[model samples]
Target: MAKNSEKAVKKTTNKIVKSADNSGTKCLEDKNYKIENPLDEEYVNEVHVSDFMKALAYDPVKGVDTSNAEHISAWTDALPVRGTTSSTKNQKKPSKRKLREQEAAKPKGISHSLLQYPLIFMIGLIMFIELIAYISLRQIVRIWENVFSWRGKKRTLRNNLRASKTYKEWCESADALDNYMHKDEWKKTIPFAYYDYRLLQKVVKHLKMYRQGDTMEDATKLMDVLYVCLKQNFAGIENAKLYSNTYLGTKALIEEYVEEVTRSIEALASNKYISIEEKRLAFKLYSKNYGRTAFCLSGGAGFGYYHLGVIRALLDRGLLPSIITGTSAGSLMGAIVCSRTDEELDLILNPELSSRIRICQDNWPTKLYRLVTQGSLFDAEQWCREAMWFCKGSLTFKEAYERTGRIFNVSVIPYDPHSPPKLLNYITAPDCVVWSAVLASAAIPGILNPVVLMQKKRNSEHLIPYNYGHKFKDGSLSTDIPTLALNTQFNVNYTIVSQVNPHVHVFFYANQGSPGRPVTHLEGRGWRGGFLASTIEQMLKLDLAKWLKVLRSLKLLPTVNDQDWSSVWLQKFDGNVTILPKSDLSDWLHTIADPDADRLKKLMGSGQIRTWPKISMISNRMRIESCIEKVRRLLRTSPKSNRVGRFNSYSDAEIEKLSQHLEQHDTTNNYANNSDAGSGDELVFLSRRRVSMPDGSFQHLQDKDSIKEQNRRRKFMAQFLDSPKEGNNSTQSSVLFDSHSDDSDSHSPPPSSPEDYTHN
Candidate 1:
């Protein structure tokens, strides 16, 4: 009876039942893995809900941890009988075509070593050798060709020299430089270096050979140095000359020079981060870190020397800034980083890629020219246009900001040159964008010239109205610009709340200039629409010059090229001409070129005794170097204050409260976070931690450090700030490298970050 009952129970358990596969799982039939229908017509509509139904028994709202639950209760407890489990799962024979494919797919019964492809490898080696031999033969032929083409090489070199824009002899403009430097009586007030005639002579020689003649001579020099002019008639000339091309063939030559210079600059093409292979960036933001406090970077002018080091440190440690304020040179670094793909960024940030970034200030000759022609300089807007023309295969400025909101650039503008200067937030600048704005900001007094924005006049293809007062400069000149504008526009103070960082607010200026400095006006703007604009308009009143487009619409003042009036004004005028009518344009330019006319300076009634500032290449370079040295000194040296790290005693709440209570501290960024500025020691400590230095002081070794430098800076800073009262000298050397050392990492590390920057 017991055996019969067990048999009945087994039979009931194996009874056929149909069920819906809610989980999409297929039921296993038997161990042999034969496919068979589990349902029969008698139980076709049956459905199982046990697995899902059991889920309701667990508590999900209270944060239950049942992830490890494993029970057989969810599975159907039925097993097939031995006599009916597909009867040994008999194999089904495949069709003839399938059998043939299977046979063909089988490997040959041979030794594994025979499949080594040694014969193919040998053939490839022979081919490579043959290629090498062929290359050698080609090189031998080239050598012979070179020997025979000696004359051709000379001719090519001569042609290249003549084609260069810097190829100049000497000009009337050079005389001013000579007098300013060589004049002894007036030299006492000016520095000795400005009187260095050799530099003046050398620059003029290169200036005269452009074959463009003296008409565009001033323009060429200005472009070479990236100069700008804020005020017109700075020399107080009641009568000013406009577009000095009064010669017959001179107009044509000037046009040729323009085209030549444009073509030449544009021809300096380079790899825009080769797109031959697609690549991924090394640093990718984690999903969890989204919306976290971002870093802020503000750019200063020509500060790339320092910004370069800071960027590398940030990348090494995976810290991305939430926002950025990129000014002059700061803008350049920002654009470079933002525009590059992560993969391209890795290669671009390297010191080796220095050749690719062209900063006009990098050269000595140009740097000198910039200082000499500070306010008298004119901009070469053509340079910006050409730069973009060559950026063929790289991510453009606009594209970099298409997603991720990594940067929020500030553009200083009046929106029209006729208007007053105003700071703009959210980078959709009226006329200029990223790179263009960068050049504008670096349009420092002695550096690059300001870019002119032209608004097409109504129904006049021949005329364009220029409100040049609408200009932009480096963003760092006013790192607080965006914040100020942001506050006013949104009607909320950033000190209490931030649009970016919620936990902490940080605003950093990567370049020079102070946040407290007010926005300055360009003197030329008022003059543009005043008597000068009227006079130029009267000159362009004639239709002939407009029809011929005579040398940058000479007929029209303030056209794109004529934004800054007054051609390279020479402090040292070539006063060699004894008697030519100022009205006679052709005779005057030619008369001064004669060697005998040089004596006219003596013949003239008397040499003016005007005092000129001593400015020269060496002095200008020294000025720049001194500024860099000062920055390094400040960063490398320990805090000068009697209270080194007073904030160590404050709690996070105390710090936050102190940061919030003070009207000086912005919720996110506080550029003037000095402890002395306010009673808050928290901001002072924060500011100290962010001081900019050189690469060597980074505390964390990026590469090749046998002794680990990681956390050394932080620890050192903590010790300095919170340690028992001690002089900075004792521990300064331990935390920083020698600033004057000749090594690559001789200086200390700059402020850390890979943050977002807004540029103006």
Candidate 2:
């Protein structure tokens, strides 16, 4: 019986061992094995079991008791550092629902996303404050200006239009422009100016290197043709001369019968006489619009007024200056007022407007705002933008370039310390012109920060075909007339690149050498008393000849060849440009008083020029020396350099004979005679009539008699300029000629002039 019982016990022990071994293998295979405890019902299936734990966790259901000392010790070791006390093992595990309820019973808190509301609200409030401040200030300024706006000297418009031109005048303009148009060299010259000749040649060579070099000639011609087509279709050249100028008051004196004058002007436009475009040209000239006028603003704050005054004078006199350029503040103002109406100018000059837009801050609001965004007290870009806004009266410069035909230019410096500045214009694209120039201009080393701008370039094959760039600043430190610094053959193809020159006009503030003094025409006929004037004269006298000699020495024009390479210091110096007011200029203006000196002066001053308009009534009188300098610069510097001479460079007799021959050839066209109604005799008639009548002013024209006299003037002018051509000539000169009477219209014939027959 004992042996059988012992056998049973051994069998039981073997069975239990087999079960423990099986559980260990299962634990290894299944990482998520669980241990069950009857006391811990809530923890059912939740307790993790390791391979080692399999040895210790014997199942109660199996009834394989851990009564052996070894088994008991292994189980105790696996129970954790502090063996499970009675209270610990008896504790039940909580269910998911019960835990969730316990979590709900704890405290709740705010979320991160929700916490952002107050911050957002604060930002919005700050922006609202800034907007309100900017707007309110602008309104205040507008009202202040309307009350104290400047009023320049009002002079009666001078009546200078002549009814007819002598033959010499007609020959000059027509011969040069018309004859030159047909020549292959001149034809290419125009296009050469539109594109860089060297670059164009390189392209041609590249396209044909594998083939005959000459083989690409046809392709080049085709490209030229395409460029011409593009220019006509997209460029703003044809309409460039158009501008809004107050009409000349003198027109009222001669426009007696409105319909009659209207008919005459219309007749001038007829194909039978001058073409419509020519008629417009003539009208513009009569209105005092220079053929190609440019208004350049300098970098001065208060100085803008002087520029505006000059512009206003130009407008009042109906002067048309098609090209507009500016630098620094000048650039800002030019972009702001380029296409503005007369009334709109009032809004531009408002003080509050200046306060808002000033790049350098005196006020706290703009400064504070700038500090916040730029992470400092000043930001160059923001300042430039504000300055533009102050001048532009708008956020973007698109509205600033509203004049359809006018050329707009702004000066900017490359952000790179080594790169030279350039003139930027909107003809390329509006965005390219404004921001690039404005920001670069304000990259004042110590003052404003530099800015980046978008640059667009075309890739022939790609639809978008463009890229952008930024990294430039205000260009005032370098070239003053950035446009003038360009090559003589600089691009003029309006469809592709802007051909406009950027002339600078400085307007200094009170603290900045000018006291923000409102201009009211200079007094004392513009004095020459100050030490400044005398010093200038002495400087001119001392150094004028040196200037003339240097100017005369150039083999080519300063435009074609600059003397900069001759200076060793300039070659070695690596520094930002320094612009100073001209002093000791005598070296450049020697022999200015001499008649022959003009020739030399013109050469030296031809490429680049600086001038102060005597108008606008500024308190500062441009000394008479300034006027002398102006004239000196206008002269021909080098006597040896003779590229071309005037049209009627010949004697009076020869020019007169040429004119008569042209008239005879146009017999089929019924050309008017010199004694016709529009002839110089009209002036004789007017002078004789003036003795018997009141002055032919606008006031006098209200009466019927004055009206009749005015009618006569218009009728005669129309007959002079709009009459059918009765002459033609085989000579190239035949293309343009004027008829003149041997018999004087007055005591002496009006001085024979090339201007008499001004080309339309």
Candidate 3:
């Protein structure tokens, strides 16, 4: 009976149901079973009022629409499945042949007919337009072809030459002419030397031989050849006078011509850099006989923008230095000036590139990380890469020197404080890589890691300055301004120091009348109290103070801060030209790591403006010197042959008279003086006080009869001189060389002497 009761209890307990009261859930009634016990009413009510139901009943905020169950279900049911579309359920694509047939069968209007053949019609119209253009503007096309097309111009010139019967016959006897010229013998004299000038001279001589026989057309062609040769070989040939049948004057008139040609050849021989404008100025200043100039650029971090302005001014004034010494940031500018030509420098220094090159911007955290780990705040490799890119190619120190004919020295100090600074240049380290040297020179201590040059390859130890282990730091620590370093290697007659350091006194001329005055009010800005700024400031101050003390010991430092101090100092130290930024631009000097490109450009412009007046003054002074030299040379020349010889009897009055004559004949195109006086043609100064020789010795005329004799001799020579007979003056000597002669000696001979022009 107990077991039966237990089974009935279990069945009854299973039948009991639990549900929320508000949900309206009804329990199913069964005839076979009945509930024994049920969940408590309070517990059921608590379950219904729980936090879970409250979360489901929560309403969202504005702009949020609650989902409609009915609508979502209905929309999902109506949506199409894969490979089926609801909008185009019954549509079918037409067959290709049927579509084509339909398109062809359509009735065509004027517009439809045109549309069918649109591409063809447009092409026909374009061709018609081109034909009309060709018919109407053929002459213009020909003119453009003749002027701009190299092949067309060359062909035209060649055809014109061929039109001359004598020239045509001359071309046929190339063998005979070659035999007479003996080019093989000449080539054996000076290997790798230029012979175009000599060959051109020979051609002129041949043309002179046929002067009576050749037609005017042939002669004009010969003149055209001469013009082409001059334009090609010489840098500044626009102002040159080419000889024709009417204007083949005496050899004296063409002495300058020969000299210019020879100078161009010499430029090639010596591997000196040359450009059109530079060569023009070179020709003008050929008589100056100036000594080698050394440019000493100081390290001032980004203040090197001032150096750019100085360089531009120097180049613009035609005072390119033969030696450049730089430290730290200045080394970068020095490398650029040494490795690249003026044209390349001009391109690199465009406003966009110049500004971008100054400072690199990086995050503070990244900078800190790099400073700790890499021993540098910035990626100096990027700077080097950009420098190499600007130069287009990498060159060794020796190669750069050979190509530019300018000595480049970069100052760098080793880790040892006791050791003196090493000047990395061609002479000191010939095989050192230029960009690497630049990197070593610019590597600032604490700020940048010392450039490590390891012996990566065998026999490549000499590729860098040091042989073994040595870390190179910034050049500023050893020598901030390496003025004396350059003088040690070369005879630096003139020193150009570009100083942008903020602590140094910027001594500039107050006016033309006053000598110079120090800009005492100028001071560094935005860098006070900073660790780097303060430390560097103190170091610079100490260095300068020591130098001042040394100068004082030598009695070269002036105590009085007055206008006369500059003159007195200059008198004591004659060859140094110091260019300083003015007080207004002092703010730029302290911005060592400036990131603004526009500010850098502005700073560079300021430097140019500050330097222009001084450069102009120097240029004028040099021009005056050149004029004096020219006059002296003319006075000393033998009247019969236009050769220089000692003439002690020549008086200063004759020299002064010649100067006056030169001033009268001075054309607007022949002279330029970039001075504040605003006269480009006024190069010759009349005042005795203004005109002083380079040696500081002034000359005055005393013997009146000697001046008359000089004039009379010149006149007498001009009246009685006669041109030489061409056949009697043939000096071409054929020196035979063995056929098995070494290829090393197969170079053209030296240029013909001045006497070679006597016959012509």
Order candidates by TM-score, high to low: 3, 2, 1
lDDT by residue (1-760, candidate 2, tens digit) is 2232334333422332232222111222233433333111221111111111222222211224232211221112134221111111122344586467554543344552353445445544654564455345434543543444322212111111111021122223222322222221221231222122232233223323312223223322222222111111111112111000111100111111121222222222222222222222233222111112245555543233224333432333233244566766466556555645544543333222322333444455755665555433455434434543433322223334443233567777554334555666543344453534555564544345454443322342111100112245556555444423221112211111111111111100011011111121132112122334324333432232223233233311121111121111101110011111221233233211111222222311211111111111110111111221121121212122211123224442343333433322221121112223232332222222322124322122335565576455444333222112211111110000011111101121121121242321
lDDT of 3 by residue, 609-652 (tens): 55543442244233333333333334332243212233334453
Candidate 2 Cα lDDT to native: 0.29
State every prediction's TM-score relative to the real structure. 0.25, 0.31, 0.38
**lDDT score, candidate 3, position 445:** 61
CA-lDDT, candidates in order: 0.26, 0.29, 0.40
Residue 176 C-alpha lDDT in model 1: 26
TM-score computed on alpha carbons, candidate 1: 0.25
Off by over 4 Å in 1: 1-294, 361-398, 403-405, 413-432, 453-469, 478-481, 486-760
Model 2 residue 276 distance off true place after TM-score fit, in angstroms: 5.7
CA RMSD for every model?
38.9, 41.7, 42.8
Deviation of model 2 at 11, angstroms: 99
Task: TM-score winner between 2 and 3, please give it.
Answer: 3
